[model samples]
Target chain A: MNPASPAIDTESVTALLERGRTLATPVLRAAVDRLAPPMDTVAAYHFGWIDAEGNPSSGDSGKAVRPALALLSAEAAGAAPEVGIPGAVAVELVHNFSLLHDDLMDGDEQRRHRDTVWKVHGPAQAILVGDALFALANEILLELGTVDAGRATRRLTLATRKLIDGQAQDISYEHRERVTVEECLEMEGNKTGALLACAVSIGAVLGGADDRTADTLEKYGYHLGLAFQAVDDVLGIWGDPDATGKRPWSDLRQRKKSLPVVAALAAGGPASERLAQILAADAQKSETEIADFTEEEFASRAALIEEAGGREWTSQEARRQHATAIAALDEIEMPEKVRAQLVALADFVVVRER
Target chain B: MNPASPAIDTESVTALLERGRTLATPVLRAAVDRLAPPMDTVAAYHFGWIDAEGNPSSGDSGKAVRPALALLSAEAAGAAPEVGIPGAVAVELVHNFSLLHDDLMDGDEQRRHRDTVWKVHGPAQAILVGDALFALANEILLELGTVDAGRATRRLTLATRKLIDGQAQDISYEHRERVTVEECLEMEGNKTGALLACAVSIGAVLGGADDRTADTLEKYGYHLGLAFQAVDDVLGIWGDPDATGKRPWSDLRQRKKSLPVVAALAAGGPASERLAQILAADAQKSETEIADFTEEEFASRAALIEEAGGREWTSQEARRQHATAIAALDEIEMPEKVRAQLVALADFVVVRER
Candidate 1:
């Protein structure tokens, strides 16, 4: 509502994220080193610190978005970025914890352009490592042993509960034939928004920001997370399989009720009707049949969804959320530098390619 | 190490456990009620508060032994049992969280005379709900907003980490052809001992006991956990399927590297050699072959383990650990009644039939 924005540059955002990874890595590694063998090895591999054979290597870990947000939020609260290291590492651990479990539960076999933890170590190991990381997140925060540390932990636990509840909703929605856009957004809020919101707020909490200030930061991050997921949903359907490193129409193949699919179905047009009919037929089939559906089957559904304006709707929604996230930054009194970094991240997350 | 023990009555121990459940159930339910939709239903079902059809039905939710220990530990610290409710619920939640995941990881279909959560709700819900419970446990402790709550939470996280580590070790041991008595016990200590240790001590910490008293109580609980698990291993191989609600020779069928199996292998006899050869051969088979193994195959291995003194060794080990646990109780100063109750629990855990 306030800004006539200049074009956001990408290099500054990349450098900020790189800075986050650099600062948080040593602490994160030291924590993982405390883990015993097998878990240590597996976690290292998942973080792209080692090759599959357990030798040192380098690969894509992630963009370090949450860590960057945490650090920036701390600075926003008038503390050094270093004050947010625990918050940064804690959120990163949680993000990966969810990923390990989510991959196994969703039956996806690859992540970060490599075989997933479950695919390589098996589902049991995936579950164990994920649980361990979640425990470690709380441990890191509480090890600080400050009143603020306990306050941040309470926020984290709440976010984690919401994150888990969202996963259940996501799974349940896959089986149901009908889902409204509102319901889909609510699920996304719980699934992705909660953690990102916590990422922004917990750092402030850790930096001794009062609840009101932290709450404002949380609002910014929540909208940013939705924007992030909206872009992901669009990419899941229309992005290049080679570039995205996923099967074509991956979400449709899995019958995932992502934003685009749900929005398309709710469009109430001829293409939407056909899409619903086909999805219903697919639902009635056995698990094997649904799993073995041809490439053409999913590709056709993607086309129908596009014809019903799902893709256009989702892209627009992402932009809207991105703008709302920026507006949220105005509600809090932050250094212009910190707000600029936050805005850069929001813009990058909404539009960045894989 | 301690005076000659008086005979402990089963009724008193049962009454203690029942009291623990009665005092902790409402708080546990209130915490669980905070979870959203399908998760709430799934968790309720897992706790035996509801039947498979979501109907209300009372069923076995396990012994509530940890809760009993927690409440009693608070009493030992000269606080009322109500002071331990948070510790009691937290440990119970962690206990059930492990069970839900372990049932899926170990592929066990039933527990406490009912189908396991994973078997009924699908593997995904099991993972998600288990995660929710773990988060909820931390939330319960931290919500008190007291320094003791933070202290208790730290202990709980450590126990939870060790618990996850134990699960990994347990899974890995099953794949190995040979496991020493020492290794098996180490794994059991991690898997079972850590949480029990936390349960007994966290309540005291919550009740404002000093570290020395909590440490002594922790030692007692650790031995008790090992004793409890030793009994469980014995039952897994030799107890009646009807009483235990498990398949015949359940541990052998699953090729579990339990104390009995390892002890028999370490016994170094003709039967032990045969058991090792059989297990090695079975390990080389495909997953389907292992899954389809006949009753006779498992029964034969059980017979070999028993003949090689595995079963007898485990039983004696249970008694030894139980005695050690009782001795540890003498290390701490407490009311005679609390010590007697602890003694009774130790006595019952070591020798009770399924």
Candidate 2:
């Protein structure tokens, strides 16, 4: 709550995101359709546009946040949002591709209130479909036939490499008894920030923004991604299951080494010591023995995480990142309305209940 | 096998391939090392440079056939082989990426006489490393900083899509009672032909070849790929295990509906009927029952496949396609020495024992 900060109108940002999703859906669909049959069918299911049986579905794809950022960045860079449709489609495809692969790697059976692609189709198909979507993203970028294609492709490719690196680190962390907060943050930056930065900067590049402005927008996105992940960490323990479409205390149940958990463990308080003991004991248990945690046990673990100041530290960090993102926007000389939209989006990212 | 065709020089072509492998090895190793550790280790092991425990070991990495084709195509198109290093690197990376994923999907435990990546490093790391290599391929192409970056990326992306499509079809065919010979051929074209075509044409494009010449080179590659796959099918059935690094009748034991099997099924003879009966009987067996197939049964099955003229049809087709590949090269007006090299390479592809 800084008094000097600009007011964020969440309603307008929501509407803008809706518009971006509508604008990008057909383009994304066409790009996906270019894949071979079963893979295309599998991708369609992953996108929430169809059921596993090939029937139409009314399932929800998430907020289309990355594509919205791309279109909005294009607008902020002095071009019509239509000019950014290709960028928007590419980002959305990449996002879905990551989701498909991550679900398989993490052994997640469900996503967005539905069975995951791997669970429905199989791991082999999921991997292939993820790969196909990634290739389609590149295909869409090249087919855009713009002068910025090379720049856009290079940026996206680098981001993808970093994203894979982040996933690898995340998997490796699961095997360790402890992970430092700094390492966790670095992983989050690569896992989440790299793609979001690409999403924002790619639009600017395509919209003909100068180098300085593009870099500034990329910074804004990077910080925004950090803020988003921080809030997500808090929600993983405390958010309503109905809101998140996840089991209660999902991350805690899985002993995920997310930011808040790492922070709590590093705090060196009585609560932190108890939390570490609980985690170590759980780790030592066989898979059959570890499955018997009661609701009360989960609730107490969440309370301990908060008692260790993990919640406070994470909340403060999220606010800091949000503020930093908005400050970066101030460095970019864009139209006032577009700047307002960007600020609102940043605010929505950190402040959303879900 | 045609007497009127150019004489094949196997020794020189073998030496040229070895030279290409030496040049591309360091670059491929460096690019793969750029992946996150453990993933890098997995990739290195997959490339046969190290053992599973990360110790250096001598392991064969196939023929580096695709990279050699890329370099030779560059030479044929009037550029130094060095000019096509990036293209060679990219093709080789894509090839290895496919191998990694394919090993996982096919449940193949062994490759190049060693444990497959998924078997040694786990499926998650194998998938991630495969993705990293694919991203690296795109990175190398863009880093080429050539005017052909977009074209090269597009060609590679399209080839990747077809490769996935072909694999999807291959998997789906396993569930079907019969697959047409033409359908089998088309799948082979997509699975194997597309990447080989990309390997040849990307080199020509990078070498500043005219569009017509590039198209001709692509055609040569396409036919060469079909011939190569046909020969591979033959080897899968009857090639010596000591030379092929696989069990004799490996494809038959797995009941793989490879081109020869499909052609035999379509031929509708007594041996074909008997082969079909054995396959159906095998399909009906439980896992434990299936595992009881004796070496004598495998031998009998291979004998039956030959009796159906499957082996003969596939061999004749391979030679015909090899001839077609040489004919396509005749349409390109390259220097005599380069033409001879290419013809030699194509002949060697069909004639290799392993």
Candidate 3:
């Protein structure tokens, strides 16, 4: 490696993330604990802090990527990370709330290598706990008592609305035979991009950044979110199950209208045609028929997707988004250290294996 | 019946309620319409503005009671009703969100003489649309762009949390063998009173009422909410199905631990013991056994509750709460005409047949 390549300081970024998570997790847990019990219990279980029986459990809480972004963005906007703590907590709460409900809606049985909230506690409890967490996010923000509390709330609310709309669109796409790549991208933007953008912009607003700087930071986060999701889509299909914590080819097996699948369908090559035939056959099968489908059949379909250039296109899209995100960061005139950290975060988001 | 007595002007109160509902329904519908389809379709159906197939319908939208309370509180706090429009819309949206989720949770098939959103649209859609409406409520409140928006959002968030807690407790009670009247009332306060109190207090806050007046008005709504729930419990068991639009003896059939039933169990008469035996027998029975339990059996249990003085106790409690509600209003020092209308609204709440 060159002595000075301008690459992200991976060690420093990791330390910053760890520090932010350590500070934010307890505040997030405390907010969840404030909920009325049974709900508190369900929320704790969802956050991997407790078992379903309300006993303590050493379980995995997903890497606090959103909270880290919020804290980092605050520092980039010229304030201490502490000034962004409330924003960090709010983003984490909203993220978990979406996960809890999304798991129930999608009938996902496992997440983060454990039984999901709905699988362990039932759908009603999951729904209620999700609601409690969403309300808790707003409550924590209002308790900030800062001048930007209202603006922060408005931002979160709008993002939440878009998030719901995006999920709704994703669900609707499942019933359609064809979905455009543009429509798929719009859905991804709403489902993932809105919240990430809100997280960074909220931190900037809380840290007293001017409107232009905050807006630029939001653009950076938005493109980063898109790049992050594109990479996630890649990992969803081809990444090792042990690393991704998902079933191998789960999106393909579920016939989800993910980015690669949509792009493959749009590619219209011979391989794309064969891939469409396989998916349609899978869709028409009964439960027993689907159960009888061999892993070899799944492998061939994945091969067809790659041969059709879907995987290549998705990787290229991720890199394109990553480049755009970095360009947006150039519009904001922050300190050199902060700019490097931001660029490193963007790079990590697009390039991570899982 | 005395002409000289200062009885409530029910006619004027009804006119005020109709006016409030008329003004607020469009805003509420517009908000629901803003949701993406089929969520928009599901929301419209839930609002009783259309059929499941998207055709227009003349269905009941409940009494619009909460919105009326908001607008009236604004007027009583020395502002025009239009000043409370946002508050009214927020309360109504929250109320509908709860209804949507509660119907799904409770597995109720019918509401307001029509099928529920969950029954027609499925639970996932119902849950999503309910979530959308909830987010929309916060969005509308924040859109007010007033100095009081943050405070209003806080009040609504707290009330919504309590409301969810109360519902969680209500579901938990269904699994328990016995519940105390005090516990039941506390649950009722959280479930019903919190939102009502929020409605009145929010209207006062928006109308620029001073703290003492707003506090007093909240107290008034809180007591009124208790009275309203007590009355609803009575009607749940004894009101005409044609009038109430619920199954005959619905609460008794479901073995709900409503206020009257709890009070009767606490009363500890032979009738109470007999009623407990019947419910226990029903609970222990198989599905087929319960199905064979006849309508005559349900009526006999209702008779047993009356013979135990439960119905009489509930009615007396309703009157007691009604008096306390009126007394709270007396401390507010509002105009004579407005106070009369407030009292009338309280009277209508406690004395309504449906």
Q: Which CAPRI level is candidate 2?
A: medium
Which regions in candidate 2 have their CA more than 4 angstroms from the true location? A1-6, B1-6
- Per-residue lDDT for A135-227 in model 3, tens only? 899999987755587778888889899899998998889888889999999999999999998888888788878778878988888888898
The residue-by-residue lDDT of candidate 2 on B1-354, one tens digit each, is 462343678788888899789888889888988888878889999988899888998898898788888888788888898877788899899888888988898888888888899998899988899899999999999876555776777788888888888888888898888899988999999889889988888887788887788889889889899989999999999888888887667787667899788888778889999998988888887756655788888888888888898998998888888888888988978878878787888888888779
lDDT of each: 0.89, 0.85, 0.84
Ranking by TM-score: 2, 3, 1
lDDT order, best first, reads 1, 2, 3
Candidate 2: tens digits of C-alpha lDDT, residues A1-354 = 461343668779879889888899998988888777788789989989999889999788887888888888888889998878888898888778888889999988888888999899999899999988888888898876555776787788888998999999999999999999999999999999989988888888888887788789989999989998998999999998888877888888778898888999999979999999988888887655645788888899888889999998998889888888888988878889888888888878887778
Which residue window of length 10 is worst by lDDT in model 1 chain A? A1-10
Instruction: Output the number of the DockQ-best candidate.
Output: 1
Q: What is the TM-score of chain A alone in each candidate?
A: 0.96, 0.96, 0.95
Query: DockQ for each candidate?
Result: 0.78, 0.72, 0.73
Q: What is the TM-score of each candidate against the true structure?
A: 0.94, 0.97, 0.96
User: Fraction of the real A/B interface contacts present in each candidate?
Assistant: 0.79, 0.67, 0.65
Tell me what TM-score chain A of model 2 achieves: 0.96
Write candidate 1's Cα lDDT for A99-155 as tens digits.
999999999988777999999988998998999999999999999989899989999
Return the TM-score for chain B, candidate 2: 0.96
**Model 3 chain A poorest ten-residue lDDT run:** A1-10
- Docking model 3 quality class: medium
